[model samples]
Target chain A: MVKINGKEHEAAGKTIAQLVLDGGYKPERVAVELNLDIVPKAKYNDTVVKDGDSVEIVGFVGGG
Target chain B: MIPSKEEMFAALAERHGTDMQKKLSEASVAVCGLGGLGSNISIALARAGVGRLHIIDFDKVDISNLNRQQYFPDQLGIPKTEALEQTLSRIAPYCHITADTVKLTPDNIPSMLKDEKFICEAFDKADQKAMLVNTVLETYPDKYIVAGSGMAGTFSANLIHTRRVAGRFYLCGDEVNGVAEGEGLFASRVLVCAAHQAHMIIRLISGETEC
Candidate 1:
């Protein structure tokens, strides 16, 4: 199982791309940092999620 | 002898009162760009009691800036930071100030932001804003940089909105909406965005909010 926003979820062999889609966010607008390393947008599809992996997704907002 | 927190607060209160003296004595901030947004933002921070301020601006004051910039007409042709330093010193006599009359590029941003708890991005160009943001994030991931955009022309005060874009990176003013090229800005909207930027910086510094 993986935790997202502090909620436990069944991993079930999901890829990073599917997890982002399941989280209800546009992948392009958000950056994914997994285990202290940034995962480029181009690799979202190839990257797979594993148990105990910490993923942080940040989105852009208007700022000066 | 070391003073207790209460004693220190009381001493500050005697000079600037509890509200302002307390806040100004606790903050260290940097303002990049001394143009329309930077000019007003620096003044507000000084008046609000930010303890230390670092101003960076390469441009010089011109006759045109008198309409919006707080600098006097006599300051024409002087570096923007120099002009702003004079004004800020008078407003916050006890505050420490460092003025840099140079552009904020990737090469020098690291040193410019050294020891600064908060940074205000008040540049006029989008590329400059992006450069500063990228460099700061790459170098100091935890440092907060509050940026402004789309404050180009005369717009209603309500149009300005301050939104958090990322951890320690906040965007203020209209985002997708902006004034067209060649348009002139009014004092009302410029000051509105400037106030929001200053307020956000204060909130971040005081730990009232996380950027």
Candidate 2:
């Protein structure tokens, strides 16, 4: 199981884009981190999550 | 008669204790983006006697900004940095303010925020917010960044809060609502988030680092 946003999940071997989609956040409005490193938006579809990886997906909302 | 600078400092010391007041007076903070969040945050920091404030913004005040931003109708068309500086000086007569009317980009952030230990991210765009946070985190590992996010709509004022995201990076907002959801920004709700950011910065300066 891989950890996403501090919770364990069966998301190993999946792309960051899938994780973001499964989490119900817009692709353009959020940023993803795979194993403590920022995953650029362009690489979301290419970067794959492995077991024991800690992922943090933070969403951004408009407004000051 | 208006009190002298020394008298104002004495009054603040009496209220906050001399040591804490001194700490505040010696601290320098950079408030990026003079919008609703930045405007309110700057005023709170200045009133607390924070020694210096570096305010940056390239936009001018418009009629639409009057609803949530701290600007007057007569000040419309004036650059936000200038308008906010004029307002802050009246509240804290002795507070030193450096206002810049320029758009901040990745290349300029380093020099703009080099001397500030506390950085406030108050931009209105999600991409800009992320850019500032990422740049500062990567460029200045030791600096503390207090950012605002998701402060829109008519939700409960108590829903707004400050949370420590990662080491030395704190975020203030509901974390759920977004203006994209069709909920417009309200002054009351926006001000609540701004207060959270301001209070968090003050806590950091006072050695109370825990969020």
| DockQ for all models | 0.11, 0.53
* Runs in model 1 lying further than 4 Å from the true structure: A1-64, B1-20, B177-180
- Best-fitting candidate, scored by TM-score: 2
Q: List, residue by residue over B51-95, the lDDT tens digit for candidate 1.
A: 889998998999977767788988999899888998887777667
Q: What is candidate 1's local distance difference test score?
A: 0.74
lDDT (10s digit) by residue, model 2, range B1-211: 7799899999999999999999999999999998899999999999999999999999999999999999999999999998998899899988888998999988999998999999999999887887787778777868998989888888898889898776777889998787777889989999999999999999999998889
- Predict model 2's lDDT versus the native: 0.89
What TM-score goes with each of the models?
0.72, 0.90
Candidate 2 positional error at B97, Å:
0.9
- In candidate 1, how many Å is residue B168 off? 0.5
Index of the highest-DockQ prediction? 2
Name the lDDT value of residue B88 in candidate 1: 87
